[model samples]
Target: MAEHTPEDKAARAAILERGCSTPIKTATGVWVRCGSRIKSRCESCAELYRGDWAAIARSGVFDGPVDQYRFYLLTLTAPSFGRVHRVPREGGQQGRCGCGVTHTTKDAALRGMPLNRATYDYAGQVAWNRDAGVLWDRTRRRLRDRWESVEYFIVREWQDRGVLHVHAIVRIARGEAPAAIELRDAARTAVAVSKVDGSVVEWGAQAQCDAFRANGDGAKTIWYISKALNYVLKDVATDADDVPVAVWRHQVALGDAARRMRCGVDCVPQDCSSLVHQRYGSRSQVVSASRRTKYRSGWSFTGLTRTVQRRLRREWWESQQAEAGADTSAVSPAPLEDLAARSRRELVARGWAAP
Candidate 1:
């Protein structure tokens, strides 16, 4: 390994403080110009943040802009894997031993250990992830065949490396009275969910049911769909050789960014925010009893109380809509009248009978 001399140490410190491309010292005590801010970044830090961004983006199935929630059943899914080693916790191997104490079982002994093992069919996992978008389409076709009310279910998968997960937002038309629960159940049943070796994929019915119960609203059926999709589309391997060049480049950039910044991908923005905060040296200050600090300048450019993402998204959407000559003002509006009207119909249909 190359030893970090004084110049190298100085360069690392400068990069850490000012970022990569800024001119700094090199190992030979020469000031070699580092990459520019545009081209230079902490690669590892970037990857981690990109991964986090991807996860959050995929979670869009769980929440969305107003007016569109009524028409979609968002979902996730995962591939099956064979059994492997076990930890004492996490419902690992529980068989008794001749020695009296419950001992951890071998890989072969735990062949049927109920879908917790990471030893998946690598090829199947890769293939599944690579074609998860297609698999989702097939599942949608199966769903339409089973349910008459279901005009179509739009299926999309978020590929986070080999871990092929899905994010399906099933779109239903207006004035449909399909039993959402039954529709979801039938879709699950019809879909050919299984391991590469042909073991039936374990549908997490309990979790899915729990999400719906917790929400306690018929309109919130999307929660169950979100849970189901998230459950099924668990981690699966991806073939490195099969990755596209562009994707590989993006992944590498993100990975490098992540490493240099010493932060996870989702936290990149946070990391950047933290650095900005440190630069400003500002602390939380409460102005009155009714209001506390919603956001600080250090954390973000325009810090506020709710939906930090809303502002960023709103701006982006505005820009896009403007370019496309679409109306941006009506994109997202929060009004009691609108909420009441939407809720009235849902409440009446659910037989709330509230005073």
Candidate 2:
């Protein structure tokens, strides 16, 4: 790693002060960032977002009347249409997959392979991802009807089989959450009636809902949701040979099939992008809502939300300064033009000649 110059330090300080942008290296080798939230696309900004999430989750920032509210960790999964390559939950388990090999951590290639690619429901998998957000929205509405208010952070995870499911941290403003059975029943109702182009969609019957009392600072629930965000991956595999033969073929086929899928309303396409866009619009990665506020879109932050964000940014900046051994001693301010000249000189010294 190269040592940061005063210009680099200034740019980073500006980002910290604004609580936005990312640090990227410029042509002159100065570090800066545009502050994107997609983890796979930009790890630097994503880490900051993750920290913000953890802080909001653990700090009672969103939960009102902390003692009166309740929380639930809900995992809603797509129904299995066929067997797929899966890691064994227990040791010494063998022959579970068609490959008949006991898979270990070393065998990342075998993680999501299907026994029979031809029989796998690739189109259905894509459809499920598209509608998962709607199903969740309906579920939240149901919760809100019963409770005073509802706020949730939903994470979409790709199963080893390439199917999408959700792990949500659901918060109710007051009162005990309904029993798991009742919650599952409500979720089933929400899924069954959720329609795409007048056709009913289903979320399968494999919903898991676990409740947590408002106790002990709510660290466990916060940590669990934060850990869920960490599982988001940019790419499952780098090369074709990295995954099983069938899995690779299936992926290629899905890509080819998706390209042909239609976009816009009323097209009812089978491709992944088209399906997701048609169902959930362009933004579908994370869905959140608060009954108390008007902003209910994906990743939208309210006024209070901004305050929490700033807090997270301050904490991150302090931590970074500590790690870099930055001096805290005050120094006399330099003129803006002098600072610019210094940066230009450093850039020229580094071979970034002025144009």
Candidate 3:
């Protein structure tokens, strides 16, 4: 890596101090906004990420021929590996823990920690996380089979117990849509035989489906689902300092199990360098939306996506510089792959100092 010049350092600092707050240097040696969805990593970029997805979520609900369709908020959970304490959210009611103790909000650290760590089935938990995507794929196929017009946007979240749980915003033709309970039942009973190990992957009994009309209640439903998706890219590992010893041990056990598990059928656990092991067997994007296909309508009516969003931002910035009469004659309109090696003049034209 080459050392940055004084002017380049100033330019990078300007980007970091102003909009990005946490600019990351790419392999091209260009300083740019860190496009992380995790708030702890980059708050500005994370909120922007959340807002962009929320807009897309709203578009699927409010835009297009929504009157002819019905919307549903569906949630599916991972099967319990073992019993855990039920500590409600702050300000909520307290309940008796399985260990014969009335636990309060302060006991929240133990909320997802197994009562008996010795028999918690950590291997099964990690394996389930690894195959969660396959299970969801099977579930969506079943839904599409039942209702041909089904389209969805799904967000997978990590539970405190280091397991993956899913929430989906589904759309189907009102004519073909059945009752909420029926949809819930079908999704709950859906199963997938993992290609990696041939083990049957199934959802937990806890599932929810709530029907909401696109016109009257669509906005509220969109808000709820988007809020639920806010934690999509959050790290599953918890800081041991604030948590109890058992909870810390639980997370360690999960990490150990994930490290030993083969990510793919051909993967050698000992030699593999995949980050899935570091993330407790979870891999793949946390947020997923249906793509527009030949015979299918996607989740977004406006075809809004992260790629589109980035392109639009670039276009908007170029237009702004054009309006300001910034000279771009020195800069070549490079291909997408070469854009990362941005010219100093281009950065200066964008109102940032550069060498």
Best by TM-score: 3
Provide TM-scores for the models: 0.31, 0.65, 0.88
**lDDT per residue as tens, model 2, 1-355:** 2545775566557545544433334444434433345565556556655665555454443434556666677787777756766655435454555667666655655666666777876665665555566666777777667753556766676666656677776665455556766765666666544355434556767787777765665576556666666654333343234555666686675554444444334564553333233221222554343423454422222434534555455467667777999642221111123333454445556554321
* lDDT of each residue in 17-52, candidate 1, tens digit only: 433333333223333222211112333323322333
Off by over 4 Å in 3: 237-241, 322-355
State in Å the error of residue 295, model 3.
1.5
Candidate 3 on 1-355: residue-level lDDT in tens? 2345775676466566645665544445555664557776667767777877877777788878988998888999999999987877878988888988988876777788898999899999999999998999999999999999999988888888989998888999989988999999999899999888999999998999988887886468657676667766576766334777887799889989999998999999998867678778877578889988887779998888766876777677668769999643322121123443344334434554221
Location of the lowest summed lDDT over 10 successive residues in candidate 2: 328-337
Candidate ranking under lDDT, highest first, comes to 3, 2, 1
Itemize residue pairs with steric clashes in candidate 3: none
Clashing pairs in 2: 22-33, 22-35, 23-32, 23-33, 24-32, 24-33
By TM-score, the better pick of 2 and 3 is 3
Q: What local lDDT does model 3 show for residue 75?
A: 92
Clashes of each: 32, 6, 0
* CA lDDT, every model vs. true structure: 0.35, 0.54, 0.77
Q: Sorted on TM-score, highest at the top, how do the candidates line up?
A: 3, 2, 1
Q: What lDDT score is found at residue 317 in candidate 2? A: 62
- What range of 10 consecutive residues in model 1 has the weakest lDDT sum? 281-290
